[model samples]
Target: MSEPRFVVVRNDEEQYSIWSADRELPPGWHDAGFTGTRAECLAHVDEVWTDMRPRSVREAAR
Candidate 1:
């Protein structure tokens, strides 16, 4: 069997996570236009999602 593929997804609050490429996405989340292996997906998230805080929290702070 082939290894599982993953897609990078982001929610309204700007949180990042990986989802199965073959499965339907959950509510309130959309694909970030990137697909790859689990590690690659995570690395993408790590590179982009530098702020761990939710969008609302970040906005409120600013």
Candidate 2:
């Protein structure tokens, strides 16, 4: 399996943020109702790679 890529995005209200681990996620995109503690967020990032699509080296390097 490949490693995960992560990006942080803030909600419209800017009250909280989510750390997305999928390579396809665009900048500034936010998911709803995805709250987690700091540690949970890190764990989510680590595990997300298992379910996320693998990115090519070129794609990842970009």
Candidate 3:
């Protein structure tokens, strides 16, 4: 069987990354609930990670 192409992950800083779904996630990261090809996952992040700033920073700005 072929491996998954990509997966979306995020860290405490709320930054997003497109990781190889065939590998293990590193520390301080969790699945962002998205899975697809690298381009697809990155497109998902592009649609979702709109604020561009960390949650904390956004909250502080308010």
Candidate 4:
């Protein structure tokens, strides 16, 4: 079997999630463009997804 591939995804609320590279992205969600093994993808999210709040909330704070 082939190795699993993962993609980091985010929604409008700024929630980060991992998705299968071979699976279809659901509506209203888009890829963050980070792809790799599950661990790598999660690490990417940890490095970049520092803020857990939604975009709107973050913007409001700014």
Candidate 5:
């Protein structure tokens, strides 16, 4: 089978979440702050994902 895909969604200031295409939000998906900037949020997301699994273009979608 192919690997899972994840989507990072920002809801409000200092709030964000991540989910898989075929699943609900995973643990630690929203343990970080939004920081009011795309770069900051993405950086935190990258850090969070790095601790769990490697990231790939195919694994992250809108």
Candidate 6:
């Protein structure tokens, strides 16, 4: 049996999360183009999503 597949996703706020690669993405979220096992996806998010702040919050601070 194959392990569950996950895809990295990002919202308008630029926050990152993982979702089932085979399922429809939630509203306001888009695929970040990376797919793999849950751990792999999380690692990718961890690497890329260095800042935890949302887009608006980061922008406002600028």
Which is better, 1 or 6, measured by lDDT? 6
Q: What range of 10 consecutive residues in model 4 has the weakest lDDT sum?
A: 26-35
TM-scores, all candidates, are 0.95, 0.32, 0.86, 0.85, 0.32, 0.96
Model 5 ranges off by over 4 Å: 22-44, 47-62
lDDT of 6 at 15: 98
The stretch of ten residues in a row with the least summed lDDT in candidate 6 is 42-51
Give the alpha carbon lDDT tens digit for every residue of 1-62 in model 4: 96799999999888899999999998878998899999999999999989888899989999
What lDDT would each prediction earn against the true structure?
Answer: 0.96, 0.47, 0.90, 0.92, 0.47, 0.97
Deviating ranges (above 4 Å) for candidate 2:
1-27, 50-62
In the predicted model 3, the residue pairs found to clash are none
Model 1 lDDT tens row, 9-34? 99999999999999999999999989
Which ten residues in a row are the worst by lDDT in model 3? 1-10
Candidate with best TM-score: 6
Model 3 Cα lDDT, one tens digit per residue, 1-62 = 85469999999989998899889999999999999987899899999998889878988999
TM-score of 1: 0.95
lDDT of 6 at 60: 100
Residue runs of model 3 more than 4 Å from their true location after superposition: 1-4
As a TM-score, model 5 comes out at 0.32
Please give the lDDT score at residue 61 for candidate 4. Answer: 98
Local accuracy of candidate 2 as per-residue lDDT tens digits, 3-58: 44444443443323356454444455565434455566656555543423334443
* N/CA/C clash count, model 2: 0
Candidate 2 weakest ten by summed lDDT: 8-17
With candidate 6 superimposed using the best TM-score fit, by how many Å does residue 11's alpha carbon deviate from the native?
A: 0.3
Q: How close is each model in CA RMSD to the real structure?
A: 0.8, 12.7, 2.0, 1.4, 14.3, 0.5
RMSD of 3: 2.0
By TM-score, the better pick of 5 and 6 is 6
